[model samples]
Target: MSAAAVAEQDGRTGPLERPAGRTCRLCGSNQLRRFLDLGVVPRCELFLTPEAVAAPDVSYPLQVWVCERCLLVQLPPLFTPEETFTDYPYFSSYSTSRVEQARTLVEDAVRRLGLGLDSFVVEVGSNDGYLLQHLVRRWIRCLGIEPSVNVGETAREKGAPTFTEFLTAETGALVRAIHGPADLVIANYVYGDVPDVTDFTRGLRSLVADDGWASIEVQHLLTLVERTEFDTIYHEHFQYFTLLTGQRALATGGLSVVDVELVDIRGGAIRIWARPTECAMEPSVRVTEVLAAEEAAGLHVARGHDGFAEAVSRVRDDLVSFLIEARRAGKKVVGYGASGNGNTLLNYCGVRPDLLAYTVDRNPYKHGRYTPGTRIPVHAPERIAADRPDYVLVLPWNLRAELLDQLSYVREWGGKLVFPIPELEVVSPAPADRPLEHPVF
Candidate 1:
């Protein structure tokens, strides 16, 4: 974005600038191409206090880059982990489907790995005991390594043993030394937050026992491209991964991919299983199959994503046009979730309160605060029913199944829900209010 536009939005006076170009985070290759640019956006998770909202927010260039050599797609790491995670407000326990997903993972791991009271488990970015709490109930010795001090404390309060620190090589080894190497190491959605994939994967390797398995879950780059999920491209996520690039990232730390599982959550994701290179099993057929699919989709090369930027812009334009038409038709549209991806979509399309009005969220921490960049007011979910708006825009579109059921009450007053990404669609709430499926981002 130009400095003039930023100045008008955030009340800044001076000229704004951001650095460009960097080596690939995985291979350190200067041979990289930018595939998508979301323009200048603030850190999405950085919610503003009432006072802070009155001040201008610092923003950065939101662009996606791909390495020619390694085929790893990334964002320039302009924001540090400290800037992104210190007082992180996203608690994983807020979504019931997500908690059930965690429980299923624990059950599967316990059965497959023969976990018992003596087995030790570790989770990086374990927010509010969403996963480890189930292990604690099973009498499994587990520890949570969390970066956010606020949510880490909540994990401890829930009887989940949590250590507040970002997992680096030293910190991972330190945790291993103090609590012993883990039988199972689980990382869900944290890989995107680490700017240095080499250090983070090494940390994952150091934390695992010789014969143990580590499962890292991240949104698949192929799915991102196919679905046009540009909203997921934010400052907090340093990179996007396919099985090929993902394996390269693991090998940096002497870990080898053994198998892969694709789950229908967060647009679509991969549950990657790896072990130390020496003891790692032969690659599973699933791995071969997924790699084949990615290759067929032209995702194994840097230029395969050539038209992603245009697709992203098309979605942005369509949504903006729809919202503008709704406004002219005398319709009211309020957002349903004050989510990070939602903020990306909002700011990229230049949707201010005049376009979105106030939004609602399930997490209480955001109730009185405002979304970063867009500065949209957040309220409790109950506000939707009380206000009876004509439309409730679903920001977290990945939670479509659950949200459809949750917002079914909107149908009481003939109100509808709007989904903005992939394509613009406005529809009545789910008719039956079905139960939530056990899938989560």
Candidate 2:
């Protein structure tokens, strides 16, 4: 094929070729190896506005590589923060679960850290102040470092006291001059979105006080590989992290991890707590155990690569087969949860409105908008009742249990629920007043 044709096929700005000479992001090693190449895909958080939808869709190549030295799994060269974060549309306040989770986290932090009026809490990439708002109400002095102007303004209006600029070393220095070091730095779900570990962590170290702590929530790479959660591999998520990689990167930036907690909030998450050297808490056994696991799993080398790719193939075949059979049987099928994972699965598997009429989400931002590349229209939860589909495909399979519990009303019509990941299963919802025998997932 011509170079232009290859570039189009790869969904990148240039031709498909191996990155040369440059060492790994964590460790300066040239032993990097190729892993999964997800082809060209659109940015996961770039939710299309109505007007933008009428224009051409922008897409880029999404190829992941494994750093032989540090075992960090990350995407190849892509856009910078300026290009990606300007007027970004994804807002955290849109989700009830997230808001509640943030509130709980703030409350827990206050109790655990002995945080009170004297402590200052700082949040990185605090989108729309979902977490900081909780701190504000608790009478704790908090500042939110947000990049997106639209999201930052919205949060400021909500009284988050946010700064509408990217958090960098220079920005951190400026903020420190005004507010001094912070007692807490929240890097929730924003760790993976950042491409540069050196810069981001340096900025984090500077903003946090000697006695302060930093808590970061990142998606577990182990879960991604084990569960075949390929849908999480999108443009926005620059890296899929294991504890080993995270620790190494943090230590290099003069921060030490004191604790690591496994959380169920976002599919599978690792909430890591860190502080400066003198105030560093002893690293938890979980941290060492995870690193050992990754080492044993051969994550540092190009191993277990085939199984993941094979699993993706099986999922595609199984889903397509199931959909065709259901259509042949004259069953109306629809999808649920118009999320980033859903978008990746739909676009990669070539699922469209034909196989599934539409998808639903609780977030209003995504309601009237369509999925990035697939053009699958997003509707509110009420549409599920108005046009009752025979089978509802749970795109965000991680939250299947929660969605099923809330959508148990569909069982009144004998409609069944479907989970495409792990495996496909048909579940009949329990009566409205009755409890479900099986959990939501």
- Where is model 1 more than 4 Å wrong at Cα? 1-21, 432-441
Q: How far is candidate 2 from the true structure (C-alpha RMSD, Å)?
A: 5.7
- What would the per-residue lDDT of candidate 2 be over residues 1-441, giving only the tens digit for each residue? 987686467553322344686567667677655667667778766666667777777888777777756778777557787777767767777667778889988988988899999889999999899999999998999999999988899999999999887877788888988999999999998877777777788889999998889998899887777777888888777788888778878887688988888877667778888998777877888878776776777564454443466677787878887778777778888888877888888878888778888888877878788888777788898998998778888888887556767789888777778777766666776643343332232
Task: Indicate the residue-level lDDT of 200 in model 2.
Answer: 82
Best by TM-score: 1
Q: Per-residue CA lDDT of candidate 1, range 1-441, in tens?
A: 876797568653323332355787888778776677788888898888999988999988887777778988888878689877888889999888899889998999999889998999999999899999999999999999999999999999999999999999989999999999999999999998899889988899899999999999999998998999989888889988999998999999999999999988899999999999999989999999999999999888655767777788898888888788778888888999988999999999999998888999999999999999888999999999999998888999999888898898998997878777677777778685433321100
TM-score of candidate 1 versus the correct structure, residues matched by position: 0.93
What's the true lDDT of residue 89 in model 2?
Answer: 64
The window of 10 residues in a row where model 1 has the poorest summed lDDT is 432-441
TM-score of each: 0.93, 0.89
